[model samples]
Target: MPLFIRSVRLYPVNDNETFHRRFSVNVAVLGSLNLDVVFHCEALPIPGQTLLCDDFATGPGGKGLNQAVAARRAGAETSLLGAVGADASGDALLSFLKREDILTHGVVTLADAPTGVAHIVVDRDGENSIIVASGANRAVPADRLATAGLQALVWLAQLEMDIEVVGGFLREGRQAGARTILNAAPAIEAARSLFGDADLIIVNEHELAQFSGVPCPAGNDAAIEQAARKLMVRDDQILIVTLGAKGTQLVDSRSSFHVAAAPVVAVDTTGAGDCFCGVLAASLAQGASVPDAVRRANIAAGIAVGRTGAAPAMPLKDEIEAVSNG
Candidate 1:
């Protein structure tokens, strides 16, 4: 099956408004919300060794929150469905989402659990090591979508939450005639059950190897394609393998293609994948073809890596357009 771009109408408004409406897509994100505690270090510590960091900071983060921000910044009507602890961290996270104009009615506050937290250490090369505490993120129920009242053309989810909960969300989205996407990050054995339910599946090289049981090295295009094809559940189902600096590879039953990443000096790689996933979902919701969506996402992610933080590093719609046109 071939994918084609949909026709877009330019509205009579300000330049920014017009551009926004041109790609105004409705997207729902169901995943986790966490407060990130970051340590800037020269190098990560080994076991039983103590390491000192140059600086430290804390901010709102989580795959769900980051992706929601990315989609909204990319000009999508985005809604987030997840859980947070009934703490100040949760309140601040909620406030941050509101400031980003993301719908938060689906995000529940739980009393018994603490807000999820991620301890991240970034080195000079922009690579990071992270350890996450599931906390309230694991408390999100499977029925959140029913009460969320979110009407979307694209439903996006990640594995930061329970597998059953994410699976339920994807199944319900499919039943509601929405295109479901699963970003199989932090790859788990149970996530394999979702490959058939999602219309689009996004993963990195390591995740591709985990899911497909194939060795997907960074530069091996043939091995990557072979692994990607094994994850296809339907003729039209598309699987995207993010190759970091090498760009991304797209595979479906009918064909496969590769898109190169935009050249940029990265200061922090955090949230680059989330930006890609969110922008990709937004583009698809707005009826962009698969190839165009991947290209736009690649450009947006390039911009994100040049900055710091996760959600805050996401590029605006016009920024991505400018880079694309340049």
Candidate 2:
């Protein structure tokens, strides 16, 4: 079956503000775009139980949006490719992106669906439980990717959208001489075959365990490296297993190393992983070495955890460097 691609240029209808930018797109992200509805609670409720919260907030989020914001704030020219509904939620998201100076030329509007949304509950510890209504995100046309001009750059992908498109984009981008980074969040079965196409695969401890069918090591770098290594089919492929608070470990064919997380008092851990991945992608796009980029990303994420929300909490390049240089 041939896929039909319908695209529209979403303008900043509600937001009447604009800023000038002097950079071109360096990183192109093809993933989910969502509006986040957040509830602040004492603790996450278990299944079959109900809890109430007093505080609530709504904002633009999703792995794609968060990463794109992180990349852009990290001083990389970034663009987003995803789908949204032709509704106010979608409009607000587009407007926010425009204000951030992110290129939205690839965001499609689905006339028949609502925009993707995430219902998130954050506890006092800054831990969260999320349930997503995929909506328009799942309906993205694979062919829409071709129009994004995603070649010859660092391409960012995630598991929030159609798996076929995720796999196809990685393959196409890599073949077009792009460095492909796959942030395998919400780890899925579809991601197994796509690893071959990714130059770098970023996953957390639990995701590593799920992918390798091994228990995530308890504070042991060797065990964590062993589990991460199982996912590497090629010698040159890199696997990054982000260990919360402890740091992130990078596994490659030749060797493995750990980048220590910067010391910080975390306030809200939401979007910390996305923060790391986005900053890493931006650093790499700017010609930073893998180790240096990872260090900067680690610091950026540490800074983000001290703040609140996802996209809004991302630190600018100056903020990250100030911490790095401090």
Candidate 3:
């Protein structure tokens, strides 16, 4: 039987928000929070070349912060579990998160560390290059993480944070019978094991090639499946390979399916992938099947690319429905 695809617009009435709230899966993001300073240029400059930028933008961005916000906007009862420096940026980040309704009870403050910061350069085509300083994000230790068995999902980004600590959460989350989801961005050597404990893994083309240990040539379906076949076994797990514009390839222990990308003239691709992960996780919490959830996530990401920054760029669930339902 074909997998049922739930309508991304399938949200219940306002009164139903309570049900979605009470019964909804709890999403806990164990990650980093950073301030992003973005520079928009008319094309990437070459080495030893000096070029003037056309625009500049700044937003709250970090794998940890972006994903957590994504989950919250996706309508999950989301919680942020991380650390930030007691600095000006941290103050602003908290204020923003509070407005989003994401619980920050677990976000610890470090006096010695500065808030993590990322300098991003977005080119004419909306592609970006980012340099990150982990700062206080690195200060979060295994001993500091608050234990929780009630969370339905625990998310982590390999923003140069310790993989062991993440693994421990997985081992513990399982003891609490929670789902473990990992977005292995900016690939790392230790990330190899992160997959073992996760129920889902989301990655882009470059990340897939490295993780699968194969030459994932830049192609459409064939290259995606060629790569997906190696990283995932049929039903053993699910792997989502994002193909910049061609859409996304989803592979699981059972099979792989391609969800075509929604058409949108992209301005900035920053935080789009993280947006996808957040929307996907939220849909799953709302009882969407994997394929259906991916469908919604694809639309959400498409909308994200059409905007600029990370937080301001993420559309509300209503906006996602409009795009997906279109």
Off by over 4 Å in 2: 1-24, 146-148
Location of the lowest summed lDDT over 10 successive residues in candidate 3? 1-10
Best candidate (score: lDDT): 1
**By TM-score: ranked, best first:** 2, 1, 3
**Per-prediction TM-score, please?**
0.91, 0.91, 0.87
Q: What tens digits encode model 3's per-residue C-alpha lDDT throughout 1-326?
A: 22322112232323423211222235777788889999989877778988787677767988878888887887777777778898999999999999998877667777899999998888889998888998988777776655443345444444356678777766676676666677777777577776777778788889988877876654566777777767653256788888877888887766777888878898999989888888887777677888998888889888899988987788788888887676
lDDT value, residue 323 of candidate 3: 71
Off by over 4 Å in 1: 1-25, 144-148
Give the clashing pairs for model 2: none
Off by over 4 Å in 3: 1-25, 153-160, 233-235
Q: Rank the candidates by lDDT, best first.
A: 1, 2, 3
> How high a TM-score does candidate 1 get?
0.91
Which TM-score value belongs to model 2?
0.91
1 or 3, greater by TM-score: 1
